[model samples]
Target: MRVLMVGWEFPPYVSGGLGTHTYELTRKMPHDVNITFFMPDRGEVSVPWMDIKRIKTSIGFGPYMTFGGSVLKESIIKSVEDYAKEVGKTAKQTDFDIVHCHDWLTVMGGICAKRENGKPLVFTVHSTEYDRSIGNPCPWVMDIERYGINEADGIIAVSKRIKEQIIEKYGADPGKIRVVYNAIDSSSFDCGLKFKPTEDLILSLGRLTLHKGIDHLLRAAKIVIEHHPSAKFVIAGKGDKFKDLVEMSIDLGIEKNVFFLGYVPQEDITKLYARADVFLMPSVFEPFGITALEAMAAGTPTIISKTSGVCEVTNNVFKIDFWDTEKMASRILEILNYKELFEEMSNNCRSEAKRITWDDIAMQTKDFYESVLR
Candidate 1:
């Protein structure tokens, strides 16, 4: 089957988990399936296995360009229109069986491609503006999301939670929505890279935003420090709440213990995972937490919030509510103080995470394509 995928950013250019998911899934897709991923002319990607097709556009296609700025509304509209026309022109020559869009950024393009090519359109919801928005989201974006849901031949949600949200928020039919869990590329994770820990490190890596619940993690950091003074918390990734989270750390008197490593490069990720004593994921509304799997795969014990979709697959990690800093702190302390418990948890997590592979994701996606075509 020939597939055209539209996404905002590809890996190496990604700001978060969405890019990672796109790269891994596409790279391992069945050899018989032909994929031509469309993105806004980013430089070369790290993975050579996937067939990536870059497109030229005037809009600033930074990682957060579509989600930010004074000209965001105009930029998104213009970008979508441009991509849609581009796809329509491409369809005149090459035939494709499906046009799949990864997020809201590419939905308009998907619609245009389907309209022009008369091929089936598939919309995958990695996240919704409702989950990411601090307050009321841009009505325009929400409207576009609803349009995609109504127009799509098939809808894929990264998690069941996102599936439920689409039905409730947009009145989407449950029968059309398919819950496909995201998988990790465990082989790409450099298990050979080893790092010696100078301090007992606690890591929380994700976009530092309100919904990610980084502030709650900071509050828990203070409590963990009170019990284990030597433990250092490394909060990685960049987002809108960077300043607020930094200030909160200072206000809570945990500045010394917390390190805000903004925008960790793709290379340094596995190193951090190997050195860290534990990984923390305190998301208020996580569709799926890929970092938890990364941590577990690296032989690092993971503690996630009960609300995370990763909890559906992860068995050994301690689960706590995002609001419960006391419980979060206690869990962190337990992982740090008790070596036997930590070792046991890490070993079990490694075994479980090994079962989740990108090859399996590709096969499931291929099956979905077959079902849709029928």
Candidate 2:
């Protein structure tokens, strides 16, 4: 099958997890399927089966203003319309069998291409605006998301939680939505048994945002520090909330124990994961926790919140509620203090990581695409 995939970002130009998902999924998909990945920009790396197409849409002042406030408005609508026209032209030229849109960014393009080409449209919802914003909802963002969910022939949700959110919140048809968990490339993380750092390091990697619940991790860090004074927490990633999180860390009196290693590159992250004793993800509204899976692949025992989608996939690691910093810290201490439990969870994490290979993810995705086409 020939597929034209539309997404907002790719690696090196990534703003979120969607880019990583697109990159890995296309790389592992069967060579039999011709996949053209259309994004705003291309990355430095190359994929053999994946054809990269760049589409430029100029966002005017109004769109920029709305984007600044995290609101999608008239400018966003105009930009999407322009993006759709460009994608429609590309679809006519390439003759792809199916059009797959990654998120709301590509919704307009997907709808235009599907209509113009008379091909099936497949949409993947990484997360909804309501989920991300919680109560302070932006009407325009929600409207765009709803339009995409309603227009697509088939939809893919990263987790059961997200699927349920779509059904309950957006009123999407349950029959059309498929739950496909995100995956990691284990081979890249196979740097075996690097020496553990002399200083005890607890690692957290993700965008520095309110939804990520880094403050919750900081609270947990304070609790862990009481047990293991040597414990140092390293947060890697940059976001709008970086300064706020830094201030929160100071106010909690765990500033000395925490280091903000902003935006570690992909290569360095793997090495950091190797040296760490535990990976902490305390996201309040994580649709799917890819970093936790990556940590598991690197043989690091992971502690994730029950709210995350990764909790739905694996049973080997520790799970705690996002608000329960005490329990989170206790779990971290348990993994750290007890060698037997640590080794057991570590071994199980490594074993479980193998099951979530990109190949398996690709096959399942292929099934979904074919089902939609039929």
Candidate 3:
């Protein structure tokens, strides 16, 4: 199968999980299936089996943006227009069996590719606009997502919750939407990690956004430190809520206990994940928790929100509500203080990660593509 893959961002330029999913999934794809990935701009790296097509654009699409910014909206439209025109030209020249798009950022071009080539269009919804904006999303972004949901021949939802949202909100046909869970490549962590009782390190890695429930993590940090003063909490990654989260940490008087390492490089995140005693992701409305999986892959005991899609796939890790900071703190202490329990949880979660491979995700995605094609 030959696929014309449309994506908003690729490796080294990705801001969220969508780009990581696209890169990792395509990286593990079989050699039999040819993939021509169309990215908005050129960035570092290249890989086998897939040809990266960087469309010339007149406008820049920033990796990060606020939906309320008019200039950002205008630039995105101009970028889309340029990308769609390139997709039209590329479609005329290449023979692809299907057009697969990731998120609303590239759906416009995916729709254009489908129109130009008349091939089956597959829309992969990593997260809806509602999920991103915390219930109040940009209307135009919602419209783009709606069009992709309504027009595409098939839809791939990263989680069952997201799949249900599409059916209920967009009134999409249920049969067309398939719930394919996100995966991680555990082999990337080359150094073997064992349970070494050292500094009680609590790590939270993700975008510091309102929906991520990072503030809740900060609130929990205070309680954890009050109980266990020797503990240290590290919150990594950057987002719109960075200033707000920093302010909250100070207001709560836990700034000393919590360290905010703004925008840790991907290369360094693996070391942080491996070294941490416990990894916590307290997302109020997370689509899926990939970082938590990465932590587990590195032998770190993880605690995730029950609302996360990652919870649906595994029972090994501790699951709790994002709002319950006290319970989250208690779990952190439970893992940190108990060596045997920590080792068991870490080992089990690693085994679960081993079961979830990019190869399996690609095979399942390949089957979904073939089903739609048939």
Candidate 4:
């Protein structure tokens, strides 16, 4: 089967989980199926059986007479029309069997491609803007999300939480949505010999955003410090909330205990996870917390918000409400102070991580595609 995937960001240009998902999905898909990845940015990466096509989104005159080139800056109507034309051209040239789009950024391109090719369109909802913004609704985003969900022949939600959000917020048919949990590349995060004595490291990985509830984690850190003053809190990743979170740590008088390690590479992240005794994600709202899986894979006990989707998969980790700082801190201290409990949860976490892999995810996604085509 030939599939044309429309996505906004591909690795190196990635800003969030969506880019990682697209890159890994295309890379690991079976060689029998031909996949073409279309993105806005040009990058130098290639995959077997997958063609990475960078759609030029620039507009200018001659080489020297250029003013400004913005293919995506066109009016929504013109952008949609242009996308429709391009899709018709590509479909005539390639004769693909399916048009798959990831998220709302590529919805216009996907809709056009689906209409032009007369093939089944599959839309993957990594997240909804409504979920990201909590209750604050943006009509434009909601409209686009609804259009993509309504147009697709099939829709993929990363978690049941997100699936319900789609149905509730956009009034999508629940039956049409498939819940495919986000997977991890375990090979990239090798679980070597377990460390006998890990440092007092508590790690949190992801964008430093308001919804991530980093403030909540900092508050919990303050409580945890009273028990284990040597404990250190490390937050990895960069976002608009970095400075705000740093300030919050200072305001809480835990600035000395908290460390903001911004945008560590994947290789370095594994090392950080190996050195950590526990991983905490106290997100106000998380659809599926992939970092918890990574930490678990590294043989570390994880503490997640009860509201997160990862909580649905494993019984090994500690879970608490995002608002319950006292309970969260108590759980962290329990993991730190009690070696027997920590060892048990760590063992369980390792076992749980083995059950999830990108290969299995690829096969499941392939099956979904085949079912949609049929």
Candidate 5:
């Protein structure tokens, strides 16, 4: 089977999980299943297992918008429009069984490919506009997302929560959307020896966006510090929320307790996972939380939001509502103070991570493709 997969990010240049998903899934796919991945030419990105087509765009639209700058909505839409035109021309000439796209950014290209080649278009909803904007989504992005959702022959949602969101928000057919859970490359976390920090370290890694609920985590950190003064909270990764979150930490009087490390590199991510006492993902509405899985694979006890799609598969990690800072703090304290609880959760989560692998995910994805074709 040949798949013309359209995505925005990949390894090394990844701003978030979408890139990692595209890279890992393509890597693990069977020899018989060939992928021709299309992406913006970020830089030197190499994937030996599959063919990569890098289309250069005039505009600079990243995975997540950086802090303090207003992103012109018109520019981004124009960039996607140009990219779709390019992709459509390619799809008309190239031979492929299906057009697969990830997120809203690439769906236009996927739709174009479907139109040009008359092949089945598979739209993968890693997230929706509602998830990003926390219920107040941009109408332009929502329109594009809705159009793709309606046009696609099949849809793949990263989690059941996302599947439900598409049905509820866009009125997509429930039967057409397949729930495919995201998986981690456990070996990346397995390579390093566990390093315990002198202080109780609570880590939050991801884009510091409004929907990420980092603000809630900051509130929880203050409570955790009141009980455990020596505990430290680290917020890694960058986004438009950086300055606001910094000020919020100061206002909450947890500035000393919290350390904001802006944009940790992919190579250093595993090291952060290994050193932390606890990993927290307090997302207001996450389709799937991949960082939590990475932390688990590294044997760090994790606390995630009940709204996170990972809650569907997770058993050992503590699940709390994003707004419940009190409970979030309590869970962090319990993990830090009780060695037995920490070890059990950590070990169990690592075992759980082992069961969820890219190979298995690839097989499931391939099966889905075949089903869609039939």
Candidate 6:
């Protein structure tokens, strides 16, 4: 089986979970399955397992872009279109048994490829516009998503929550959608580097956005700090909400307790996960929270929103409503104050995360591809 994968980010060029997903999934594919991966030409990525084809576009936009200006917004919109057009042209010449794409960004290319080759088109919905925009989804993006949902031969949703969203939002056929929970490679968290903190560190790492529920986490931090005064809250990753979240911490009087580390490098990620006393993922509409898994795999006790797709798979992490700051703070304090509970959770999560591996994910994906082809 040959797959032509249309995606945005992969491995070293990643801005978020989508890149990690692509890299892990592709590398673990069955030996019989040939994958020719197509992505925007950021640089060259060579691997013995698969053939990578870089598609060049003049657009300079990236994933999870912050909307600071109309010019930037317009540029990003044009970039996606331009990328799709370029990908379509490339796909027409490439030979593959199936067309697979991630998110709306690559749907057009997938559609074009399917049209040209009459092959099975599989669209994977990592997230929707509603998740990104915090309920107010962009019509343009939504339109594209709807079209992809309707056109695809099969759909893969990262979580049951995402599958439900597709059905409810776009009236997609439930039969065509399969719920495939994302997996983590436990070995990836081992870099031999450690970040020893002077104080108890509470970490929240992701793109700073409205849907991330960072503001709610900040509100919870104020309460947590009142109890654990020396505890430090770290918000890592860059987004449009960076300045807003900083102001929020100040307004809540927890400025002294919080540290905003913008755009953490890939190498330091494992260290941050290893050293953090507890990892917080307070997303308002998280389709699937991969960071929560990464933290849990590192044996860091994780506190996640109930709405997260990851919550559906794991019982090792603490679950709470995104708006419940009081409960969020209480959970943070529970892990901080209690040694036995923390150790038990830490030990159990490490074991639990290892059970779900990318090899298993690749096999399931291969099965899905065969099912779609049938």
| Least accurate 10 contiguous residues by lDDT in model 5 | 63-72
For residues 1-374, could you state the per-residue lDDT of candidate 4 as single tens digits? Answer: 99988866767765577778888887778877788877653557565557777666532211011112344234443544454456456655666889998876677678878877688899998777786776775566568789999999899998889899999989998878998888887656656646535578899998887788998999999999988999999999887789999998989999999999998987798998888888999988888888889888888889999888888777888889999999999998988889988788887787778788877778878989998998
Runs off by more than 4 Å, candidate 2: 42-46, 59-78, 193-198
- Candidate scoring better on TM-score of 3 and 4: 3
User: Which pairs clash in model 6?
Assistant: none
Worst 10 residues of 3 by lDDT: 59-68
Q: Candidate 3: deviation at residue 363, Å?
A: 0.6
Candidate 1 residue runs with Cα over 4 Å from true position? 44-50, 61-70, 190-198
lDDT per residue (tens digit) for residues 243-343 in model 6: 99999888988899999999899778788898888999999988898889888888888999999999999989899999999999999998888877788
Model 5 Cα lDDT, one tens digit per residue, 1-374: 99999989888777778888999999999999989988888888887899888887764767555223235766787888988888888778788998899888899999999999899999999988877887877787889999999999899999999998999999999989899999988988964444444569999998888889999999999899999999999989888889999999999998999999998887788988888899999999888999899999998889999999999988989999999999999999999998888878878888888788999889988989999999
Worst 10 residues of 1 by lDDT: 189-198
- Residue 185 miss distance in model 5 (angstroms): 0.5
If ranked by lDDT, best first, what sequence of candidates would result? 5, 6, 3, 2, 1, 4
Question: Distance (Å) between predicted and true CA of 343, model 5?
Answer: 1.2
Give a tens-digit lDDT track for model 2, residues 308-365: 9989998998889999999999988887787777678777787788788889889999
RMSD of each: 2.2, 2.7, 1.5, 5.1, 1.8, 2.0
Report the Cα lDDT for residue 82, model 2.
Answer: 81
Q: Write the per-residue lDDT of candidate 1 for residues 1-374, one digit (tens) a residue.
A: 99988777876677767788888888889988888777777677545654576767655654332265657668767877787677566655666898888877778878888898888988999888877784467778889889999999999988888888999998899988888888876665537433334478999998777888999998999999998899899998988789999999999999999999998886798888988889999999888899899888887888999887888877888999999999999999988888788878877777778888888888988888888888
Worst 10 residues of 6 by lDDT: 190-199
